[model samples]
Target: MCSSVNAELLVDKQTFTSQNFKTFNGNNIKEVNVGWESYGNLNPQKDNVILITHYFTGNSHAAGKYDVADASLGYWDAIIGPGKAIDTNRFFVISVDSLANLGVGDPHVITTGPASINPDTQKPYGLDFPVVTIRDFVNVQKLVLESLGIQKLYAVVGPSMGSMQAIDWAAAYPSKVERMMSVIGAGQSDPWTTALLEHWATPIKLDRNWNDGDYYAGSAPIDGLTASLMLITQNALSADFFNQLGKQTVPFQALESEPLHDIRKSHSIVNWLRSRAQARATTMDANHLLYLVRACQLFITGHQHDFSKAIASITAKTLFLPATQDQLLMPYHAKQTHQALIDSGKKSQIKMLEGPLGHLEGVTGISQHTDAIRAFLKQ
Candidate 1:
């Protein structure tokens, strides 16, 4: 089925700007802009629309080739094409770059974050930018859709943090969102998950070069940013997968990287992770990562403090797809949320992705459950 997915679905980034947008916290941003991408066609009734919110590190490119020869495809290419689970041929698939998206340095990504110029001061917002929330993200997206005269959504789907947004949608807008597929999702950020998210912000703050998120004009916290990225990558991966890769670096092969050889030296695995992070960081901003972390840490379904009351607003037929070996969010995270939905008398289903890849399995091994997803969408 994956092989049957066409790689020819090319797309371009478009910008949406909402003026004097007031955040949920009562903070007003002069202008908020974000990039979005869409595939397939929107029917005249405007009812066949599916919004795919992206994961932590992902952008608006959910399923398409920016360029045909580009080596990488959109993150969910396998299930989003002509005859795939999402089947673009029959549905309009759209994805938007999140507020304070990490990919600020990427040419295709347009986001309003710490690095964007503050119109009032003629300089980058830096730390002056107001803190944002998951609610703000959904509101901005609502503005974008409203701009296109689109009302009501066929479904909202996402993975990880995106799943958080999807659930938020069904809760905050019960009458609008018809279906929701939350992959690696939870109903709320528990104390443990909240604490883990704090760790991601800590690394960026500890970097001496961070300057309290004012490093835009300076050297930038490359070290701290890379470390933060590495932390997220490790947390998202399974121990067995890391161990398998770590074994490739034997004692002798790690000689130069051995601390015995030099205090700065480290293992090949460490270097490999750092290198991978460095590549991603080139197009990422540290402040944006911090802001995004806080957004995630503050998230709860419907943005309500009461758990039971929060999910009470959901009217969508929901599906919870958790990675079987996920070490970061863990299967139990999804389980608790799924049980809550059932207890609340909401339509909900749970399915586990079986694989050794852990959190990554939801993306890499998703095709294995195509029938399940396809049927869920059909219903």
Candidate 2:
């Protein structure tokens, strides 16, 4: 089992704010505040630092419980701690919440998004927040590192949306990062992936209650938000996994209903998905989710026009770990990026993770590749 130095780590949330921040699109945000958390100690030279970015729905809590009584550990608690794969015992693992983070309502997450109040107008930013990109996430992280006097990174790593940030870090600051890893992710959002992301936001937009992203004063677009989450949950899984779900709950009840009178009825699996999304929606904001979707869709290494030139600038030894069954960010995304890195003569290697959970395997099945990660880090 993965364990922290103190048995179960009791971590605290810390805040980092950047003033007069300029976004990749030439937009200016007066202030950007994001929560961060750290595991292990920063060595004197600060060279032992390893930055781990969080996924789309995740916050900065990457490896510990916020309190002793907490019911669950961080999502990746399985392979990040004292003696685990990333091995916090010898390296300082740090993670920061990205601007437009989906978990904006979680008390543990400090992020500036559409849900945040604009100091100038004393109202929620709504759709007014500047369009932030993965490069902006990298820049915010860089500011945090500079604040702590950390100049060199031992490794920059993450999965899903986090992976995009990891790749951007290596490409943007080639001299500062030593190693990089992208799990269930790619270097850029291709045309296909970008189009697919639009579906996640469509349900929310279709909700009349959304009121064009200005629903903060009244009822939230719960139905739309729930549908969006359901789609995300489904897309993140494979047909192999989907078939196994709701096995005990009959496959179809709507079809068997008396007189076939209702078109609103759904299958057990649909209800199951809605229930899961409802549980998660309680602490989430609809606008924040929309912003995150846009941020993900706009991702590209170095945030430049020349994708080739940007990726070619990376000097960090790279490792790409793609899930064999992922349908969301398919394995080919990682393969394509890895091949480019190898062609450029950069240290790059690819590994496959196996599990039924699909894209989520990158989080739940990370432990299976402990040896591979340990070996890569050592190299």
Candidate 3:
């Protein structure tokens, strides 16, 4: 039962342009306006801010309640409340929407990306929008912070894609954040992860309806999107979960009894796959997804191209919490980040949570980590 506040609008809600908005590969410049939401009071000192970044489909809603009045409460309602991990009572939380979000469905969400208004023909930019990087996402965040009169952050936090943004914040503006936590995420995207992500994009690309990503009026690649999500869930879950929950000894008759597509659709594929895919498809811009994937592929921590250097550059008190059973981003990635920070002479903590639920444990069921996050935020 998270509630909403009627505070004066913080961001002016307009388009922004920047010549320095370069792509991850340093290819070209772009303009961006990162949409966001803020909660709690920004004390006169302006140091009591807590930044919350969202995952792939997550938006400005991070806590108590505030996306659409009819929609369910914030995705992390259990952890973000008056006295929960985020503690709205003590900290003002600010969550941001990434560039090229399709959530704001008006005008077809032509954001700065491979799809945006050309400004020349007044038509959809369609591939004209410059590519955006994670660093670019952080830059827009800086703009929002500056505009709102916030000079520093008490902490920056999130899980999954949000975690990447959190890490970038600490690395890019070490002086601004005092603490940073990344859950179920890695400092850099590994090839295995990238390969899987490419698969996710494949269905969309191969579908005839994709139409070179210019399919505005024609049918969308819903089937391909659905199939890709089905694959994603299988890869993301842990063996323990299936062993416990799946039919261990289905009758030979049952195997023959169940319809093929029905069986496929029934394997939590509804809750786990369809829900996530539809959630992502509705809000994420097709081209923006490409931009984000490329940005993830470009993730490096240090020495211009080394992840270790990127990890070493982080000066904020770091906490890397990855689930022990996570298959997508695996626990080893968290351990790797933690070890890198420690080896860099930074006192970072690496604690793993044991869960049968793999990567999803960081989201759908995150109570244990919520407690850990509470303790961290308190400090």
Model 2 gets an lDDT of: 0.89
On lDDT, the stronger of 2 and 3 is: 2
lDDT of 2 by residue, 3-58 (tens): 35457777889999889999888999998999999988888888999999989988
The lDDT leader among the candidates is 2
**Runs in model 1 lying further than 4 Å from the true structure:** 1-7, 248-257
lDDT by residue for model 1 over 34-89, one digit each (tens)?
99989888899999999999888888888878876779888998898888899888
RMSD of each: 2.6, 2.2, 4.5
Which residue pairs in candidate 2 have backbone atoms (N, alpha carbon, C) closer than 3 angstroms, thus clashing?
none
**Tens-digit per-residue lDDT, 1-379, candidate 3:** 1234552122212333444455554655444555565566677788889888777645666555333443455566677656677777677778767776535443322235555555566666656666666776777777778877888889988787778888888888888889998888788778887886787667767888777777655676666656565666666678787665544432222344235446543433235446666665654456555556666666654316666667677789888878888888888777888888888999788778677888877776666777778888777
| Residue 237, model 1, lDDT | 89
As a whole number from 0 to 100, the lDDT of residue 348 in candidate 3 is 82
lDDT of 1 at 336: 91
Candidate 1 clash total? 0
What overall lDDT, based on C-alpha atoms, would model 3 receive against the true structure? 0.67
The Cα RMSD of model 2 versus the native structure comes to 2.2
TM-score of every candidate relative to the true structure: 0.96, 0.96, 0.83
Which regions of candidate 2 fall more than 4 Å away from where they truly are? Answer: 1-6, 248-261
Ordered from best to worst lDDT, the candidate numbers read 2, 1, 3
At residue 96, give the lDDT of candidate 3. Answer: 69
